[model samples]
Target: MYLTATLDEMTEAQLLDHADEVSRTQRKCEAQVLRIAAQTAVLNSPETIDPDVARLPGRERVVRFGGVGTPDVAEFAAAALGARLEISSGSARSLMADALDLMIRLPQLWRRVEALEVKASYARFVARRTRNLTPDQASYVDERVAEPADGRIPWSRFEDLVAGLVVASDPEAAAEAEQASAQQQVARPTRSTEDGMRGFFIRAPVPVVALLDGRVQWIADVLRSLGDTDGVEERRVKAVAVLADPHRAVALIEEFAQWRDGSGERPDVDWSSVMPAITLHVHTYAGPEPTDTVRVEGHGPVTGEWVRRHLGPHARFTIRPVLDIAGQAPVDAYEIPERHRQAVHLMTPADTFPWGVSTTRHHQIDHTVPYRRDGTTGQSRVGNYGPMSAFHHRLKTHGKWQVHQPVPGIYFWRDPYGATYVVDHSGTRRLPAPEPPSPAERAVARALFGLAA
Candidate 1:
């Protein structure tokens, strides 16, 4: 009835229900698409088509599709995927690689996706991340992340865990990658924008960026006080234009500083405090054989040595005291403790609901299992905690949506109609609901085997 109704005819709840149903189907279709792409690559593989066969110059289909001789770049296997998908050859190659990576390197994950237990996009993302890894390295990743059952809890906890594993798997390779990336530093002008604005793309070292950004902000703030009738950001753009004429820029900033000495207003950009303050959350690995790599939270993997070199000893450090997330004792009070909040954020960085990615920054830490009126003991504990946006927290508290944490961090969310989703560190995934038998099938079963209806 909901499906047959027009959009305007449906209620708010009905629209949400329809959306969930549509998302499940879309995931299933994504799996099929990956399979079809894999088959396309197989058909175009150099081994299959030009494997030292009749040495003839005319047999050039294999080369035209993908450079058959260069198996190192899997995209060269053929342009077949690109051609069929009506995409660029580069995009086609990346697609082919992802599909093959899922099929071959991570067969376990691939199977779970095809079974509709894991999300296809989730699997595809993991595939791309692990594509550079060797078979053994990929196997190490798959063994931990992939599971037979649908609601795997560790999936939530593997936040960039695969990336850490990939780096740990090969030290020399990580170092070489770091060196290669260092060689690719560039500065170039970008194409003009619709608003007649042009920009420069500068890939410089951290120190240079810190100095440049600090100077730009200093000038922008001066422009603001000088009655430049532009917004702060607009002033910042004009400040960059001032930077192009370095002598004039320096003179204006100097005059402002001399006059502002008596104005009694604290300067916006304090170079003394700002220059050395580089806030980073870097995770370093420990072993007898030290690795060159460290995982920066927001930034991708960068070498540990490079971080030490860039963020010199003068840079301040605040090493977070480690807490046992699983073993922490529950507090007696209703108000969530600061320590407990940190554990909640660290344990499950994102909201423990339907694919919501809000962490403590935008989330109000919630007790996943709501506190009872008469309850007093250990109700505000890390084991019972989740970070949710205010709106979503209200939804769970008031809406018919129900959540049950079978394990400490793994949450199973069920809607009113019994459609369930599992949420954790890896993100949310829908569970496959079993279909009930029709009346005719029940009758046939009863007659054939004398089973009870």
Candidate 2:
């Protein structure tokens, strides 16, 4: 008997080789199991067995008579396989059905699987997909798929190839199938989950889904332009809210028309109330120009092209230097300045909590050391300030969660359960690194260069 080597004793290359061998073995075992199930199905087929054919006592030959039908065989097989494989009876039954389908409908595909030339899962997938296909059409699909010159084909590509072949081989059948599918399209009733959340499901045509997605994205883009720097999920919810309200819908359409035609009066909408101030960060040393890369507050790093396209000519620009304060003593200021607030927003654009729920505009400037607990207000200094979502700020303030800023943008957070985590631009991480400069820095650098010329 061959002894298996321990993982600790194996080299990296050896471990990889062992993994491939194990995968091949597993595939072979799966193929063998499926083949056995198929064989058992045939053996118990009523058409293949005869009850009156058996003879006893000095008979030249004796054969077993009529066995159980397919239903009885399936039940026995499911029960036995379920017990042996430690799977549910329904799964076992499904597996047996797929195996029989492969054996009877796509024999060549089944043979390739049995020989381990094709994976069992792939064979099962082919079997299920070709159920609607005639034997000839299935054979054609099997011939195209089974023996790829370039080893195993990827599942996604395989699916596409099968779909294309199916449509090309029988367009009328495909059309009928599509018509049947359209008839099945429906919007399911809203249901409540075990959790507090409610779920709604819709099964519609692809074009309808695409239109809905485009509309949502348009609303989200508008919100972002107005300084509503919420996450994608929040923006989507806001889009839905706008769509549900007839007043907001009309306002949005009017704004869109005015922007498009440049003829209508400016809408009396107060964007300042709805929008948050966005700060963009850029690193001067990274590239010769500011447009090389840009970072948006409440959003992570974006390309220079994105900055130029999104910010455009109408957006305002401001330039400021990074604050430098060297002292252990806290500053006396209770209220943070606008410039300090912007700096804090630039440093930690999004919420500095693990959940990253809100944008910097919505976040509160939290003192690393609470003032009531002898913590300094570290005035106008980036090191003293951190932006936290309202929820997380309350948790730290009253729920006994401790947060410390060892560096300007890097924060260390300790939960009530004693687990410590590092929070920064990339959300929660195990290690700390310097935060990149905001887009405002890049904008300033670009303007200064333009003026000097």
Clashes of 2: 9
RMSD, every candidate, angstroms: 7.1, 20.5
lDDT of 2 at 81: 71
Cα lDDT tens digits, model 1, 162-209, are 666667677667767766776778778987776777788988656556
Native-structure RMSD, model 1: 7.1
Can you list the residue pairs that collide in candidate 2?
50-66, 51-66, 280-438, 280-439, 280-440, 281-437, 281-438, 281-439, 282-438
Q: List the residue pairs that clash in candidate 1.
A: 65-78, 65-79, 66-76, 66-78, 156-425, 156-426
> CA lDDT of 231 in candidate 1?
88
Q: lDDT of candidate 2 vs native? A: 0.62
Number of colliding residue pairs in each model = 6, 9
Q: After superposition, how far is residue 45 of candidate 2 from its true place, in Å?
A: 2.5
**TM-score for each of the candidates:** 0.66, 0.50
lDDT of 2 by residue, 1-453 (tens): 113778898876567557767878898799888877666656555444333442444422322211111233423445577677788877776677778767766777777787777778877777767766776777776776666411233444455446655554565676556557658777765766856766657776444454466677777877676668899889987887897797986687567546755776866555453333433444322434222334443233334444454454435666555544332244467677776776677577667765454553767888776655345445436687878777878888899888888887878887665556777554454332346556787677778776321
- Candidate number of the best lDDT: 1
